[model samples]
Target: MALNDESLQELKAELLDELVKEVPSKTLLSLRLAETRSADIGEILEEMIEDDEELPAALSLLDILSAERAANVLGYLPGESQLEVVGKLDDSQVLKLLEEMGSDERADLFNLLSEDRREALLRRMAHREREDLKRLASYEEGTAGAIMTSDYVSIASGMTVSQAMMRVRQTAPDAETVYQLYILDSDGQLIGTMSLRQLMVARPGAIVDDIMIKDVISTRVDDAQEDVARIVAKYDLLALPVIDVDDRMVGIVTHDDAMDVAESEATEDFHKGMSIGQLEDGVSRVRLWSLYRKRVTWLVLLVFANLFSGAGIAYFEETIAAQVALVFFYRY
Candidate 1:
């Protein structure tokens, strides 16, 4: 059974209490932290921020995790917490964390950095990593390129199932997903695809092209992310391939990222429905003037619309008074 929020909150309290105790059992704290979910840890960190106390202990606990785990947890934290926490990390530690992050997430964090800080950080990364960041960051915020991650497995068409299997095994550790494998041509065009199940059951000597699905479902790099999410949902896909104008495979948008995009789009629509502007953060966190700007424009237009409506009614008053039934019907 899954733990309820109450249980998770209790666990958080226990960890915080341990942090305060004399001779704090680092071993126990470490074990508990390991057992907690990254999202829950992020929530705990958020609570620490809200209290303005226990913040040091929460930050200290973050340092105890491995760079990869820390990065994962950090990704779940709010934007404000992310900047503060990242600022506390040493240069090397920050680099390690960024390297372990998914390309889309790394791009998001990189975009948040100031120009000078971004340049400084870029200098520390390897040539390939720096280039990847630059490419990923170039995409518009709500496009497929902005959400897609490059950590996907791909192989050439001529490779046999045995060879493909070997390649997948070699690359799976670094890939974000391995369930769906892409088959590419020499020119790096996505030619076909195969699921892990098909690969597992096929004869070792069988060529990938023979067993792969030639009808691939993919989205363009510049496609709206909501449209990409619709594709994934419509096809019941685990991952959808992203392509360039030339039909070459660029990256894959995993199901999880698709869902996030869906949620974000829905939230934006919800704001529009309520006559409020689209806001990625909670209303409490938004600047008061910014909120006014989003709403006041619509409100002002509505006032004019109401004024026009009143004017039209006044113009028709004599006609309405002659036939009161017309007024009732029109109002109805």
Candidate 2:
């Protein structure tokens, strides 16, 4: 059943009280609780900004909301206020939030932060998490690897279906999708693949090596993200396996990540064709002059190119006048 407005408000209030009093700040609970809209809670939290010690609490409140919501609220705040909130988050918290965020969304946020802030956040993250983010960030903005998550399920091919199922139960919580399982050889080479349905119906003692499909559709790490999307859409797949140079399963790109890649690629192409570079969401929070500076570089280059086109048109004016009567014939 849907939660009534009054019930949501009461829950929000209880959550807010807990956020203000709980140890370690009940970060996850606050995030889950604020999933329901509570404008009054937002307003109350906004008012606490005036209190010096309340900054952490206010930032925590914003962090608990969805990333898009946080981006929207941050956009509405003044530059100083926005920075104050972002500044309070440590690198680990920022990394956790980014990990939860969609690829384009995370890139947009990363673009907004200063280099020092970005470096600090990366330094604070765990080594594996940091490498994952760096490898993702390194891909061209429109590529598949840039948006794909490293979270996925993989098991050794020698394992029986029952053994794999046990591993899935233990690891599913951290995986982005568990509908498909990737089978890897002993050297961590991706050898085959299996679906949850197949795994479920297979004999408990049957080895994955015997039942898994060896001819799995996969994409290389360097493959264009657009190609990845086309493959997934064409196959109607829930997830696409990602492999490295050695043919090892590095990660799986889930359906949600594929959708985000398509959307981001579309947006970037639109902006580029219009002679505007990609605009990150945080740009809205920056100063008007700064925003103009970001855009004017592209506009200036386009203007100069247009000027050359005008010159060429002027040079052709005499020829056009001489051939004025030819215009109607040309039209035909």
The candidate scoring highest on TM-score is 1
**Candidate 1 deviant stretches above 4 angstroms:** 1-3, 21-23, 282-322
lDDT (tens digit, per residue) of candidate 2 on 4-59? 65865566466556667756456566566456444444444554565687676677
In model 1, what is the error at residue 298, expressed in angstroms?
Answer: 5.1
Q: List the residue pairs that clash in candidate 2.
A: 144-225
Worst 10 residues of 1 by lDDT: 46-55
Clashes of each: 0, 1
lDDT per model vs. reference:
0.87, 0.71
TM-score of each: 0.88, 0.61
